[model samples]
Target: MKKTIITISREFGSGGREIGKKLAEQLNVPFYDKELIEIAAKESGLDKELFEEEDSRTSKGFRLLGALGYSLGGPLSTITELSLNDRLFLVQSQVIEQVAKEGACVIVGRCADYVLKDYDTVLNVFIHGNMKEKKERAIHSYEVDERDIENSIHKIDKRRANYYEYYTDRKWGRAENYDISLNSSTFGIDGCVEIIKEVAVNKSL
Candidate 1:
């Protein structure tokens, strides 16, 4: 049997991870999320904490700094110094490619779509939810306080966007960048998983 690889890119509180896990279960395939980080860390000989920090925040810091000291000038050259974060990203990118080549799996975030964009069998998906729905989900699922949910959402999404844009030539969450874009808020997590499964099975056939 031919294997199918699904890559899901999602908004911070959209339950995209849950959907990916469910899809993997339904498809009887391996599911990858933070497991990617762990694998990357082991392969790259980098600390897991560094990978977590650099996962999606690289571009934001540089953008905020502007083309000033570290942005475009001498400090920028210094910034070129590959921090542990850069090394981790490079290692993780390789690991992601290796995993995709091994078999069918559902990979969530960390620019897996871009990493495997050249693969003919990969199906890339972008999952997002409306602000209200996302916030509610974050609060309930993550146990984030209502007061902190909005800020957490913003920070995480921004970091994800920054990381994606920095690494991939494509824009994050843009419909054009993905083979399919689904709103988890519209169908809920399980429904979205079902949709993904149907889509994957149909595509394989």
Candidate 2:
């Protein structure tokens, strides 16, 4: 069987990360989330904190070379300096490509759906759940601050959507952008995993 690459974009506090993990485990593929940040930091020799900051915020998301998944061929001499956000984006593109090349993998967030657009046999999925369901997941599964969970959810989702749109030139959460969309609240995590598995199987056929 051929390898498959799955990129999952999700709303904040929606248990998307967890769903990706479970799906990868079920599919017996590697799962990548925050691991991309460390890879970028290591490859660029930048501070991990810097990458983390860039990873979450959308302010500097629109940088040159972000449009086409920064070319990995040239030496570092061409670009004199890179902002943390740009460096992270470039490095992520490299890492995402490398991992997908090795074999099947499930990648969560970081606008991976856009970065891996050129790769064949890639499944771009969006995972979202109802606000109430997400709020509970945020507090329980993610251990988010309970005091102001509502605003936190909205704020984080906005950042993700903005970063995605800024980098990819595509609207986030739009049905047309992805191959499959799932509401985790409807069938829960495992069910979503099965749904994706079926779709992936069909795609392979």
Candidate 3:
């Protein structure tokens, strides 16, 4: 039987992780978030701490510039010259592909949607919330000061966007990049999970 794999990409402070977790529970499937990096580290023989350090973070401009220049040389040169972050991305991408091939799973972030884009049974989702709601959620969930939340939100989202764009050649958070784009603030967390579950069931049928 075919399996359904849902890939969720979200903005910072949007509660996408919670929604993905809940959706996985409702569907009785495994959920992957940062754990993907761990698996990738183990599978690829890369250091786990280095994987965590580079995951979902922006690439350095100098390194990207160097990579661009190096790409003009030859395929072998380009591959050999990849920055540490880019190498980690490649490793994690392989791990993601392996996991998807294994069975059904709900994968959150790390460009999993793009990694699994060619799979017929995969559903890609983007979750986002208004700035106000996101800030409130960040403050409550992370126990951070209100003043710091805005900057934290922007910083993290920018990093995610950069990381995703760097790897996928796609605009992050754009509706065209996903099968469904949800505003989690509109219906709240549980409601959003229910809606996703309903959609998953319908899609499976």
Q: Who wins the lDDT comparison?
A: 2
- Candidate 1 lDDT tens digits, 1-205: 1339999999988999999988989898888896755675586553443444442335433433332112222344356444555445565666677788889999998888877877888888999999999998898888877987888999989999988876666678799988789999899999898887877777554
Cα displacement (Å) at residue 54, model 3: 20
Alpha carbon lDDT of each predicted model: 0.75, 0.77, 0.75
Give the per-residue lDDT of model 2 (tens digit) for 14-114: 77898899988998888989675456447654344345444233423334364564443354335445566666676676667677787889999887888
Give the range of the ten consecutive residues with the poorest summed lDDT in model 3.
Answer: 68-77
Q: Which residue pairs collide, candidate 3?
A: none
TM-score of predicted model 3? Answer: 0.79
Model 2 segments beyond 4 Å from truth?
A: 1-3, 40-81, 203-205
Estimate candidate 1's alpha-carbon lDDT, on a 0 to 1 scale.
0.75
Residue 162 of model 3, lDDT score: 81
TM-score, per-candidate, Cα-based: 0.78, 0.79, 0.79
List the candidate numbers ranked by TM-score, top first: 3, 2, 1
Model 3 per-residue lDDT at 103: 84
Error of 2 at 19 (Å): 1.2
